[model samples]
Target: MFCFQCEQTAMCSGCTGHAGVCGKTADTAKLQDELTGALIGLARSVDGNANRPTASTDEAMLAGLFTTITNVNFNNQTVQDMIDRILAEKRKLVPDCTTCGSPCSRNDDYDMNKVWNADADIRSLKSLILFGLRGMSAYAYHAMVLGYSDREVNDFFYRALFAVGYDYEMKDLLPLVLETGEANLKCMALLDKANTETYGTPVPTTVPLTVEKGPFIVITGHDLHDLKLLLEQTKGKGIHIYTHGEMLPAHAYPELKKYPHLKGNFGTAWQNQQKEFANIPAPILFTTNCLMPPKASYQDRVFTTEVVSFPNVQHIGEDKDFTPVIEKALELGGYKEDQPFTGINGGHEVTTGFGHGTVLSVADKVVAAVKAGQISHFFLVGGCDGAKPGRNYYTDFVKQTPKDSIILTLACGKYRFNDLDLGTVAGLPRIMDMGQCNDAYSAIQVAVALAQAFGCGVNELPLSFVLSWYEQKAVCILLTLLHLGIKNILLGPSLPAFISPNVLNYLVEHYKIAPISTPEADLKKLLAK
Candidate 1:
């Protein structure tokens, strides 16, 4: 098996051998590759047959792609089943091809090796587009669950898949790569609108770090819909729900947080689950990615749903029945007394929900501060947090930020310093937690607004992006930033292994992107500029 799809890949290169760094077995990896190939085939069929897919077909495409995302699915059986469903959907879409006498490559599955082994430059660019779409699909899937679907976003998935399987030149592939960013931008907006419309626009809310006594459930992943259903089902039960990882943003959603039983956020990012969840006398539910293989001690306590799966773990199906998890939580009996936990920075509470809508609602005050030069610099410290030790850079960087500077963060990475009491700058919270990775859209919106207010390009605004990436969602968000010509961004703890030298050079020269150095060095350079 060979996989280089995430930040913590073996030794900063591809993961080879029987198991990936994320604990994905060789069989599961191959099944994911097969699932991806089948999706490409379905896309080819869609290209040939212009009719729209049925509801099942549409959902299969989304789930298949989402399953192949890093840390999402670890069950080979489930992945192969998804591939079979994709083939079945293709047959439904192009039944005539099976009976046709003429030779047809349109229905044939694409060998991903063709793109994986192509010229280094082409491979890098295609990886960007493919991985970006994988991330975008996850967001689209979540929005779709809530009855929010965009024709443009769904249509682009097929178009992007078709391009991945084609023999296109750099000129052709490059534009589509950027279009992935462009399409993702719209997809994120649709999700934002979906979330805000369904659950009121997130307002600034403080979430506790303490885990209350009694039976509690720690919910991870990026799906609020699943969290909501569980919250509804667990209402009036002794079970308490604590947001974990990407689900931390759920605390900011008015509709979800209205449940008095919905407690504070539980651990840091997804990578620390092995240590964090160990011996925890409660069941955990994963709604999306960054699921590492559960340790033997915690295996029974981990529950999976949606596209996230691990062999042997109890899976809650679409019926959204969570009795198994609830039973486990009750059996565990939880802590005898409330356990007071603090974040890495030792603060007992963290705040989030300063999304674009909330932040923009207070735009007048922020603008006035900027005009008065009271708030000197703005740092958007955002992206996924991982197990890598170097990720401490984020915590330290946020720690070292001046009191007068504003720090904007999103995604799971913000957990590193979200608990730090950074105070406020000119009446604005020094550290503002945007929503999830897709909420990068909110940060971009705030930046654009600031740029317009200052009468300059976004690059000229007193804002800098220090991003840390882990999975494909971060890839798409990074591409979106590049598409907007945002420059001098600091990206780390390491660059992608899939980025060949030439492609890396192109990004460095064109975008002025650089790998992160020490927190002090980076802060100096950022301030010097």
Candidate 2:
């Protein structure tokens, strides 16, 4: 099997052989590819057939794409089941495609191996589109769970899927590649709307890292609806709920935080799960990607839901019954006393919930600070965190920023220095935690608002984006920045392995995108601008 859809691909190239770097075996990787190919076929059937794709077809496509994302589903059986669902959906669309003597073959499942073996430039472009769609599907699926669906976002999935199967040149694929970002922008908006309308807008919230004694559950990944459901189920049962990883920001939402038993955050980032969750005394449920193959000691307590699946782990099914997880937590019984867990930086607690709404509400103050020279600059230092060596640059970068500058961060990457106590700037916390990775939407909103208030384009403002990426979600978010013509992004620990030299060069020349160097050097260059 060959895979290169993430930042941590083997040696910065495609991962091939028995297993991927993420612990995905060749069999699982092949199944994911097959599922993707089947989704493309399902998209073709929807394109050819008269009837619009059914709701089940929509869900199958979303789940199938999401499952293939790095570190999401490691279970071959579930991958095969998703592939069957896609094929079955396709059959419903073109019932006689196989039976007709004069088969058009327009709805055939496109073998992904063809893309893997295509010309380098074409391959890179298609990877962008495919990976971007995978990222968008996660956001789209989350919105869907909250009963919010956009026709434009849903239609783009079919359009992009069909294009992947089609033999397209670099010119043809490039536009679609950016269009993936365009669609994802709308997809993220739909999710933000879904989350705010359903849960109410997030506010500035400070969450402790201490886990209170007694029974407790740790919910990870980016799904708020899942957390809410689990909170409702475990309520009044003496089970305290703790946010982990991306779910760390769920504390900011009124609906979720209203739960009296909803306690503090646990763990640092997704990459440290093996070490962090290994000795935890409670069940940990993964609602999305970023599952590091659970260790033997904790695999029994790992519960997966939605598109996340692991072999032999307890899975909370669509019924959303979290009884098994709750029972596991009860059995473990948690720590004998309150566990005071600090972040990676050793701070007792970290703050979050500086989303677009929160930041924009103070737009006048921010503009005034900039005008008065009280604020030096704005740095958006956020993205996925990985076990890669060079990732420390983000910590150092945030550390070296001018005291007058405000650091706006999101996603798990912020865990690197979020607990550092950067103090305040312009009467605001220097390091402002913005929701999850999807909350890159919030960062964008704040940047656009700042630009507008300052009477300049986003790029012309005193802002710089120093981002780190780990998976396809980062790919789609990067594309969204490019779509908006945002420039001068500093991306590292390393560039994606799938990007061909030409594509990488194109990005550099067009977007002024560069790899992260030393924090001091990058800070100087950014400040000099």
Candidate 3:
């Protein structure tokens, strides 16, 4: 029952004992580890057997990998069943090659301990690649749902899984690590294309912080496809859909937002759900991760789908039928009148949808403002928000930013200040919202373009990245940033416990990475430099 896979691990070390900080039981952790081991075995089998997976086999691999992601699944039985299925599929995929006299190494299950307990330097590099791929797989899984699949991305999953199990050296693992970033970049581009083509390019859309009165559904997690399905099913019903957590970006999508029932976002990041979802009259649907254990008051009303699951919560199956959730919302009957909700800062609403496409579309205007000296500095204040107290630095950092500075944010971390009315600076929104974690790709794109336009290195641009990480997706995004040699990133609320001293030193010396300090102090230093 030892787990250190997330930013909020117990005391910044590992989570052990009865339950994890995220409320995951020891049993659940063991199940996840078993699922991961089975996936490794399946990868090994694939090396021996050349035949393509049956539909169930493919589904098993996708769901099995996704299930082990932080905060995604919590059911021991489900995870074990998934592991069993993966083993069955492996047997089917490589039946004859098991007896070969030659030690054919095409497919073999890797012992995770090999990587987890390797030399600090090798382990750090491999962890970066493995976790990065895990995050990328989530994005790939989402885009795949919309019938937008990439051969390179999908094939790499197997290759990466194979590497995770293999006895590869640091030299061998390092390239794969960078390749994860490269592959993720492409995966994100595919998602951006899917989202833009399906929902139209996200424009500068302001989402309300206030939750409307009456019966409403607060949906969280990273699945827009599930949200879209719910939106379609709930159309014309009295039920109102409020985006929660990662789903906040859905408001920016013209296709999803066109529904009158699709209301504003309901709460902050995923970590606050224990309190946020408590005693709410409406049912909530979790389409993805960072799902903390639900409190008793709202547990009955929680609905899970896709790879996300909890012990007793009602699960919407493959048919995507949401009748149970709808019934729960109706049963709760909502508030007698419209209930009003406010953000952490007590703001009535927040703004979102300032994705790269939107920001870059107005690139000329932004550049003009910068050249004119109307915009003093640009701060990319974004990443996964956590419950750790130090996270307030983000809020204060944004608050203390100069009037002429622009704050560009993404992911749930923006919840800390998205509600703040920073107002416009030099004709551009002072606080710009780039779509979800994956949309970090968009930020990178804008940075590269700005560097090229200014005839300087990206590091030389008047831009700084103050990032907060909580999960594997953030891990992958950071690697992608490093792959491009973006330096001097301010990462906090704390550094990863999994990072050994030597590895940490390597990053500090090579990348000039540092943990965050007080907002005012950090702001002064960033600007002073």
- TM of each candidate vs. truth: 0.98, 0.99, 0.95
Query: What value does the lDDT take at residue 519 in candidate 1?
Result: 93
- Among all windows of ten consecutive residues in candidate 1, which has the lowest summed lDDT? 48-57
Q: Which residue pairs show backbone clashes in model 3?
A: 44-107, 44-108, 110-165, 209-349, 213-338, 213-339
User: What lDDT does each candidate get?
Assistant: 0.90, 0.92, 0.84
Higher-lDDT candidate among 2 and 3? 2
Rank candidates by TM-score, best first. 2, 1, 3
Report the candidate with higher TM-score, 1 versus 3.
1
lDDT at 123 for candidate 3?
Answer: 73
Deviation from native of the Cα of residue 408 in model 1, angstroms: 0.1
By TM-score, who's the top model here? Answer: 2
List the candidate 2 regions with Cα displacement exceeding 4 Å.
Answer: none
| Candidate 2 accuracy as TM-score | 0.99
Model 3, span 170-207: residue lDDT tens: 78977787788788888888988888888888876777
Regions of candidate 3 where Cα sits further than 4 Å from its true position: 52-59, 97-108
In model 3, what is the error at residue 182, expressed in angstroms? Answer: 1.4
The C-alpha stretches of model 1 lying farther than 4 A from their native spots are none
